[model samples]
Target: MELHHKLRRDPSWHPNACNICGQLGHQAVNCTNGTINWRQIYGDEAFTIKPPVFWSEMADKQKKKEVDVKELARRAREYARMQCQAQGIDYDEMIRGAQVFQHAPEQKPQLPVTSQQNGGSAGGAVKKEAPEGDLPEGWAVARDAQQRVYYWHKKTQKVQWDKPTKDTPVS
Candidate 1:
């Protein structure tokens, strides 16, 4: 009992418990077990106990991003131009001109019940004419789904067509 008391009283003896290994006699560094890689083991908690990361080590995740979409698109466009050049195709000539998309015609509103009883529509209302258009220029003969033949007039933008005889079946 005296010897045990003397050992406890010795200067080298550590009264407090070790945070690592939990041994009482020595400091954590003097532990018999190999040094713990707290960063690997405890992860985020390691930062609380250890020296912090250097200022130079900080980074923006966006700077490390894999690809720029605009850059990729520009590269792809260049590649297409190169391929067109290789094939002896004129890039400008190969491109068909852009066309405006036609929207569905707006529906005419129904006459009010009171207006119908009055025997006339509103004074401001007027019927709209459909746009005058025909088959594309240079197209000789146009065929409808029913196989009716059409001749387009470039000047008048009119389609002059022959109606199929009733006896001639469309398939």
Candidate 2:
């Protein structure tokens, strides 16, 4: 008892209590109580402990949603088949036509057609023939596959869609 009293009286002798749970025998850094008594540690401000998130449960829910979507798709297909049968339409042919329409290339609006003798080109471009000797010096006229007339300046190596005359800039 004297040795114990002496040891307790020693300056190095100290007792440890957890700042988290206010329990003896452990410091806050070494606390292992699994839960902290916040009211005992931090004066009386209310605190709520949130539950831990489980990623596996979230992944399971996502997989279940995917299965439900697949089931809905199957039901829709069966309903469509029944409707087609009632209408006397071939279901497979109708499905194939729908898929073809979905995957088919888009169509472009068509231009009006005119006979080639009327200056209509193969590519639907309307062209007019320029009179010979109408081009300025160093400029020559050429026709594209569309029969569209284009002008080229030989000295500048410049090409233009419009016929180049003396008033056309060199550039």
Candidate 3:
């Protein structure tokens, strides 16, 4: 039997609608109202028999999102590299320091604060702490050959690999 003949019409036999042009009677794949014709619209080289109106829309959105994310990530990496170079430190070392911050808890880690030798201000005696848990994923605490510990700071937009001081060696 023919496919249409074997099928029985129901009270809700509403025809398929086209997602692109918002037309009824025929689905987007079989639409012939000139709104979307795969062969003519995309050309023979890009034409495909398989309908991908929904999938293509989703894929396009995903591709755009990925592009935006990659651009942002590239900018951040470049800024980090530049900051590390200015401080006479390895860029990779700074990245490793960011890892330590990533795995730590929400609360900022406490380090000893020393008063300014110039006797600037009492507030200068307290060292401001970095914000907690804002680093990229897959980061870990690592040190360079100099055994310096890296730390991430939002204010400077840098990952600092602090050298061991005379009072606090092996930081």
Considering summed lDDT, which 10 consecutive residues are worst modelled in model 1?
Answer: 123-132
lDDT of each: 0.50, 0.69, 0.53
RMSD of each: 23.2, 17.5, 20.0
User: Which is better, 1 or 3, measured by lDDT?
Assistant: 3
Best candidate (score: TM-score) = 2
| Selected candidate, larger lDDT, 1 vs 2 | 2
Writing each residue's lDDT as its tens digit, candidate 3 over 26-119 gives 5556556545567676687664467656988998988877757788899999997888789888988767888998998796554544434313
- Residue 11's lDDT in candidate 3: 28
Ranking by TM-score: 2, 1, 3
Q: Candidate 2, which ten residues in sequence have the lowest lDDT sum?
A: 5-14
Model 3 misplaced stretches (Cα beyond 4 Å): 1-67, 106-171
Ranking by lDDT: 2, 3, 1
Show how many residue pairs clash in every candidate, following the order shown: 0, 0, 0
* TM-score comparison, 1 vs 2, better candidate: 2
State the lDDT of candidate 1 residue by residue for 1-21, as single tens digits: 246644544445455645345
